[model samples]
Target: MFKINNLSAGIGGKTILKEISLDIKPGQVHAIMGPNGSGKSTMAGVISGNDNYEVTAGELLFDGKDIKDLDPEERACMGVFLAFQYPVSIAGVNNMVFLQASINSIRKYKGLPPLDAFDLIELIKSKMKLINMNPDLLQRGLNDGFSGGEKKRNEILQMLCLEPKLVILDETDSGLDIDAMKAVADGVNAIRDDQRSFIVVTHYQRLLDYIKPDVVHILKDGEIVMSGDYKLALKLEKEGYGWLS
Candidate 1:
């Protein structure tokens, strides 16, 4: 459902991704593992149409059409979601209200009527239950003073509400405890279907232990040096990235 061919992207005048090529089929989970500064987040940013980066070369295609020109909101409305490595805390912004507005906006974009307050609340409560989340969180500010695990769960909550076709989780397991990580993985696993695809970028294989990927790619210096099945993640878990260089 997503394809990148000879794609090079960067910020300012520095190119981070060099001729990166990938073909992700529907219902596939592709895990990208790499060292710091390997452009994992940059690639995610570029794919989600972050304006900070510039695409100097190649194609960023979603469903065979280039998405480099689309804005981040456009991509989100088109079934693309990115969970950031560091979730921002917006003070004084009620999370429930914010989520409702965001979901209704996407619905409007799709020419669907906005859901009523009761229906929206019930839907959110149901999703929160799916991830074992505390519904009281809906009353708090958006990630305001939330623990790392809460913030990550909020991202997954958005995923459940948005129901996007392409989900990019950028280190969703970072700073999470074992139980928290499992909860997040369960939320992700619950949403997996034949039409949805995932690009899970992480520094460890432990996350893959719960959300197994169909393919694993080791990225070094902004290039994919190796690609294999789940065994690649296992090997990297046993032996670190030093062996690849």
Candidate 2:
């Protein structure tokens, strides 16, 4: 469902991802593990159409079409959802209002009618329940004054509601306690099926214990240094990246 061929990218004048190639098939969950500054987050951002980085080489394709030129909103409309590592808190932006507009925009793009107020509320409630999120969250500004766990669960709630085909989770497990992590993982696992794909990016393998990636990749510097089945994550957990040196 997604392919990155010989992809190289950088922000400003510095290169971060170097000739990184990955193919995420439908229903496959791929986990990328690496140390700090290893370009994992950059890979997710580039795939999500973040304009801060320029693609220095190769192509990014989604569903067999080139998406290197598309904007972030266009990519989201195309079923690409990136749950950010650090969800920003935006004051004065009603959470429900933002989500309603977002879902409606995607629906309109697909030649569907905007969900009416009644239907929208129903959808929100169901998604909130799936992630065990508090409905009271909607009463506040988007992520404003929310705890780390609340923000992370809110991200999962958005992904569940959108039903995205390709989900890129950029360090979704960061700062999450065991219970919060389990809640997020359960929400992700609930939506897993044969037609959806996921890219799980993280620094540790503990998160993989819950999500169970089909493939595990170890990234070093700007390139994929090693990749294997789930055992690879276990190996990294024990050996760490020092073995590579």
Candidate 3:
């Protein structure tokens, strides 16, 4: 569903990712593991069309189309979803309103009719059940005064509601307790099907225990140094990244 061919990206004239290539087919879960400053998040941002990073060389293709020049919103409208490492707080925006506007925007882009208030409410309630989210939280401002676990669960809720084809979760497991982590993983697994793909970027192997990626990639210095199956993650857990260096 997505392919990156020799993609080299940088910010402010300094290169961060060097010739990174990856292909994610439908229903595949790919996990990117790396130490700090290895450019894991940079890869996610570049794929999602963050303007801060400029693609100096190579291409990013989504659904057989080159998305290198597409804006972030355009990429999102085209079914690319990035669950932020740090979800921002919108103090005045009600969660339900924010989500409905987002869903409507995507639907409009696809030439679909907007969901009315009643339909949107029903949709939100059904998606909320998937993630075990509190219905009351939807009435509050987006991520405002939410606990760490709550914020992460909220991200999962958004993912479930949007139902994007490609999901890029950048450190969604960070700061989550075991229960919260399982809940988020369950929400992701629940939505997995033959038509959806996932790119899970995380530092630890714990999350993989639940999500169970089809491929595990070790990214270092902004490049993929090794790619293997699930056992690779188990090795990384026992032996630190030093041996790979």
Q: Could you give candidate 2's per-residue lDDT for residues 3-71 as a string of tens digits? A: 999999999989999999999999999999998999999999999999999999989999999999999
Q: Spell out the clash pairs found in candidate 1.
A: none
TM-score for all predictions? 0.98, 0.99, 0.98
**10 residues in a row with least lDDT, candidate 3:** 124-133
Native-vs-model 3 lDDT? 0.94
Superposition TM-score, candidate 1 onto the true structure = 0.98
lDDT tens digits, residue span 142-223, model 3: 9999999899999999888888999999999999999999999999999999999999999899999999999999999989
Model 1, poorest ten-residue lDDT window?
128-137
**Each prediction's Cα lDDT score?**
0.94, 0.94, 0.94
Tens-digit lDDT track for model 1 on 171-199?
99999999999999999999999999999
- Point out where model 1 deviates above 4 Å: none
